[model samples]
Target: MQAFTNADMSDKGATKPGFAISAWPDTRDILARLYDLANKEPVLAIKREQMERYLGYFEHKCIKSKSMTSAAMELIPGGVQHNLAFNHPFPLAIKKAEAAYLWDVDGNRYIDFLQAGGPTVLGSNYAPVQEKVIELIRECGPVTGLFHEYELKLAEIINHYMPSVEVFRMLATGTEAVMGAIRAARTFTGKAKVIKMGGAYHGWSDQMVFGMRIPGIGALESHGIPAGCYEHTQECFPNDIEALAAMLKNNEAQGGTAAVILEPLGPESGTRPVIYEFNACVRKLCDEYGTLLIFDEVVTGFRMGLGGAQGFFGVKPDLTVFGKCVAGGYPAAGGVGGRRDVMQCFAAGLQGLKKRAMVGGTLSANPLSCAAGYFSIKAMAETDAPIKAGKAGDRLTAGLKEIIKRRDLPFVAFNHGSICHLETAAAMLMDINNPKIFTEVSERKHVMEEMGAAFTAEGIISLAGSRLYTSMADSDAVIDDALDRFDRVLGSVEKKK
Candidate 1:
């Protein structure tokens, strides 16, 4: 892979019209800082008394949430339906969301840095998009189990913004889209093996559940999944072009590789960011190896800008996986798009063809989701939501760095436009080969969980206590307020004995 240069950074860092990231993150520097923090002894953590007070907020102010979750635990596994909802102490039941805020069942408003897992770039419950969805629902209901005009509109808009996406096929979720993309790649290339960067999450599909979250620990979390499911799935460390090439070379003797799928911004939305030129290098390798490249843009589809990371990086993959902002935070928000020849493998209806990749969803491309997505993209373009959101992220990251410095903390902070990361414990950066990986991860994770609880107590909602996705609704005032809250939380941290 090519080394990053000042010119390279200048070229891609301009936040061109339609791109979300105002500046690409310094991947090498960030990684070095994170690794240093990970190797340090006596992890910086919230003081025990401070953590008790933060937990007290959950016990006292969140009484209703606790009661509701306690009752729900009897029926719902882990007391939450979604992974994102599973908080440290207990999940808070959100009653309302608007702009950059969320109101819990107890009527406590929080700065919604989670942004519905990076979908609502225009902010939570954006009025214009919500009104369009309401109008559509009132006219035709949410789903009709049949053709919808908005589906075509949504696909057309996607193609317009992403010309490389010659055709689009809507699905119900990012998982389904990944399944479809992989199947299409196999059919198109007549190969069965697939390669993904270790630690990159494509979704929860059986074949994709391998090497999740932390790299080099393949199938550690694949409890219910059988070994046969991921026999053909291979993983290589992120940004290691040589390893990827070697894997592709090895696959040639084992029926060849069908596709190389990855989250364009790196695993977990840049939690493990890639160098600016990494995607281009991957694209070249895919062409050389006769493999399809699939960009999983579930979080970056519209949030990273209308053109997404692909457009911003000037790299075109053979297939693009869409989710999250695809439906503008609406349900059933996912799809796959790519070269015309490859996408034809998913041609709907029974048409006798040499090959076909089967995929189905009752609610896929329903009227409600389509309308929501169509209007949301339009709104994002009209208001430059991605750019505005990116600016907000820049402000938040800058403020976080200042706080980390002022507090003399070892935490690292950085951002790729709207997606920001604050690495307090560096739990995710732990080396896989460490003798006490699991034990260290657990200890560091506890610290992270405590940090998340502290943020919540300070009236801020972050993803996993590390990631903060800023939206267009996050104005300078909102960011400043969040910074104040962040300052409080950071200031409360102390080295764990």
Candidate 2:
């Protein structure tokens, strides 16, 4: 194997240091090339064949999982509760997970690259966080509906690690955190419009549903939601500062822009990476317009680092939303953090005394979750888990790229620290502004889903065949083993041809 290096990769420019927007201005061009490569006839045919073969293996080998999926379909929509659980052949009924591995009910062991959909950076079932959660549960019971010390501790730790977050408010889920962030932004700025990156997912919230995934198709998946819900919401192209500026200017004439929120690494956790200086540019824009800049870090928060992408990019947002690892992989893991003045919108008050954002949850900041989150952040810092996972990610990225290059395939693999994206579908390159985005995305959807099934069949689970989140558990040996599994899958292209 030729030792891999990202000598001419897209992430090199996407992850460049400092505030120069011109650095790596050709990122979109690099991405377009990858997309074109994946769409080639020979590559599509190979991927299609692998998808079929893998689906057959999944149906034949995973009898118990098939039966379970069938049973669950009676109650669960699409045979799974969460969208991530919906795999091509039937979702696997995982018996348990520890470190970087998962075991299905049928005794199948697989290397977990999904990482519970980008949360378990320290690895699934991380001992320290789990132990802390259990201890808290045994001691103080789960929820008190009152203040808890762990809440203060968690908030304080996050603020310490991410200085931009001067104050914080725990929430029940990423959806609620996002909703709260928007509410705070509106309350603070007294503006009615918000701008999000097209194709980025902030949550399934009614207002945020516009321009999801396929983009340009406002409220495409939101059948029940009325147009009024997203009327105040607008979308601009990812990495395109000019589009954002135009949207802001337009909104100002109607009603001033409240906030401009984004997944700082770009839509869908760097599936479409931004130019290195994009965040700083946005920061400058928001400052000029008096619009609160909110970074939806639910996926990027602790996964990127204690400070998340905001820390990595060195551009401070007025507000930040978090999820997943924020609560150490607990069931309810999310919160909002921001400057003291902006976060004051979430402060408790009497009904008529002060205007404030209405945000509260039955389980928000529960002792168990807070304890787990506090311990998780502490452990991540103590063990330098972010740096370790990032190194492992670099190794995995290099190795996967090597396989794709060696096989003469058009696939692309890149990573930003621990968060990795392997874009065989190259869906991000689709121009969301075009009316044809719907047809284009639909045409490419099958191969992408099949690619995910192929990875699962090869004992390598991924985030819908597109993304991988590496954790500290993914040491050199683990990454090597995973790369070996990936190579086997990629090598199947030769067999198919």
Best by TM-score: 1
Best by lDDT: 1
RMSD of each: 2.3, 5.5
lDDT of each: 0.90, 0.80
lDDT by residue (53-158, candidate 1, tens digit) is 9999999999999999999999999899998988989999999999999999999999999999989999999998888888888999999898999999999999
Clashing pairs in 1: none
Candidate 1: clashing residue pairs, number: 0
Candidate 2 residue lDDT tens string, 400-419: 88988888777777777777
For model 1 the local lDDT of residue 136 reads: 88
How much lDDT does candidate 2 score?
0.80
